[model samples]
Target: MIYSFRNSGFRDPETGVYNQTYFMEVFNREWHRHIRDHQSLALLYLCPHIHETVKQPHLLEFFMKQVQEAILRTTDLVARLNNNSFALGLFNIDEQGTQIVLHRIEEKIELFNLEYGKKYTSHVDYELAGYTCTPARNLRIELIFEDVESLTHELEMEKNKHIELRQMQ
Candidate 1:
């Protein structure tokens, strides 16, 4: 018998990585695995800043592609969740492990900035927030963060403050 495989084709056309639809499917599977196996998972949400310096929208896509290439691991799930937000699902990992991943991503961003030269202004600046959970915890993974909106607001404020400080220099 001949086998015919069907592809879901759920990837961001611009970044060539999983889109939100694929991400949600993978995330649900990982969540189920975490519940069944008593494993831990980390959800990192990243928001990229929009800047006037970017002349073309495709450039933003290229920048995100660079980010995806820099941060993704064989086991990690990365996806573009929205126009300016991306999400990463780290399975069977702890807080420290998540921190290490975040650190590496930040380092890659810095390296990308350096490589792009001093005169070019980058269109993206990432603000990251995360949540960690395990099966044994008394808390519900979905309810761990009750106020993502406020948290994201605070992060944006903090980022703006940093940008203002840099402008002063």
Candidate 2:
């Protein structure tokens, strides 16, 4: 049987990216597949820091477009976890490979800022938490998720401190 996404609840309405539910489902399958195939998988959590005042629907769309362009492989998947946060699943990639992809994404955002920075007065201060693992008997998805979530939260806390400092200055 073929599955259609029209009513599948697998996509985010706002960003048109895969939803968390779809990501989780795919992640489980991919995990086992990697174990069987002896491949690697990388997950990246990205938070793009768009100033609260500059919130725009089109901006998010543009960011996601940039993300798609940055992804090296057609097999990689990008999903929207929330308005400002996104998750990327990179298949057949090790830790070093994940860094290369992350760098490319950062470069794209830098170029984007060069074009829109003047008007928006806010750049993409991204917080990226990445993990790469070969599927194994001991690999626990929850632990990886917790680590990334904690890292993302730490970055947010740091960003908030800087924002407050700038406001006070």
Candidate 3:
């Protein structure tokens, strides 16, 4: 929503949102703006359950729609990442605001699951990771992106540990 989707280069044709190339462009500009304005910026990286998505090809679209609806701010945006994952950016939002949006998304997703389970006898699952960049000196955009990506790995690890624990029990 940050830019006009009319330009094919700026948007992913299928998702009709910003593509990875455009995302980095905006992120770079936003990084400088964040430094100048000293405002809070939150980035969320989401990876839909690929296995489930294979069974339900529309699952990613449904999840992305929920995320888009949850983030109502004009300044907030969602972009397509590699491997069917996505990145959401919220500018001028603090940690609490970020948490609220996350909760909103989770609630919507839970509702979708409930309805889907009742009607289709299936459930959707996804992994989410978030990081907020506060006003700081000498912060690099590359590192922030890397940190969020690393968070994805950490979340997967935690999920696997839980699975292991459940198997043990």
Candidate 4:
């Protein structure tokens, strides 16, 4: 996250993490830097698939906490894209590294839910789009976010289709 010593307004008021505006600035800078330096960059879109029936106000905050904790490296960034959705930027990491970070966050959430039991419920699904295994493509940071969001939406559709098919069975 690009921290401006000039002002603290870049941070999300709720999660105390970088907001989308700050994230975009950092993403533009980082994308250029990565291109010049031949480094890897990845962005993960995390969405908490919370149903409307589960009205837990603190759920998003708690998940954001888990995300903030999981991304320990100063180079990594956590941003609140909106309510119940977050964006994590991983620099100097390829697809494998992104998966590792995702799993780490998942494990943390699982442990939290296990300990809290029925009183609290925490669940999330994520999608990742980043540099290819080969670093030859030039892409925009916004496209990465858009790609992941589209993939996540498609996955949700497939999952719902499966559920309907099973019901018919």
* Per-residue lDDT over 1-169 for candidate 3, one digit per residue giving the tens place of the 0 to 100 score: 2345367777776566678988888877887888888887888887766463346655666667777888888788899987658898888887778888888877877887787778676676677777887645676677767777777777777755211000000
Taken over the whole model, the C-alpha lDDT of each candidate is 0.64, 0.74, 0.72, 0.63
- Candidate 1 contains a number of clashing pairs equal to 0
Model 4 / residue 139 / CA error / Å: 2.8
Q: Clash totals for all models, in order?
A: 0, 0, 0, 0
TM-scores, one per candidate: 0.77, 0.83, 0.82, 0.75
Reference-based lDDT, residue 28, model 3: 73
The Cα RMSD in angstroms, rounded to one decimal, for candidate 3 relative to the true structure is 6.4
Clashing pairs in 4: none
| Model 1 Cα lDDT, one tens digit per residue, 76-146 | 87788777777777888876777777777777666766765465655356676766677444555455333
The TM-score obtained by model 1 is 0.77
Task: Estimate, for each residue in 1-169, the C-alpha lDDT of model 4 and write its tens digit.
Answer: 2346655778876567888999889877887778778877676666666567777666556767876787778988888888756777788777667667766776777766665556655445443223322222455455666666665566556643211000000
Name the lDDT of candidate 3.
Answer: 0.72
Question: Lowest lDDT 10-mer window, candidate 2?
Answer: 160-169
What is candidate 2's lDDT per residue for 12-98, written digit by digit as tens?
765667888888888778888998998888877888777778766577767777877899798888888877788888889877777
Query: For model 4, what is the error of residue 14's alpha carbon versus the real structure, in angstroms, after optimal superposition?
Result: 1.7
- What TM value does model 4 have? 0.75
Clashing pairs in 2: none
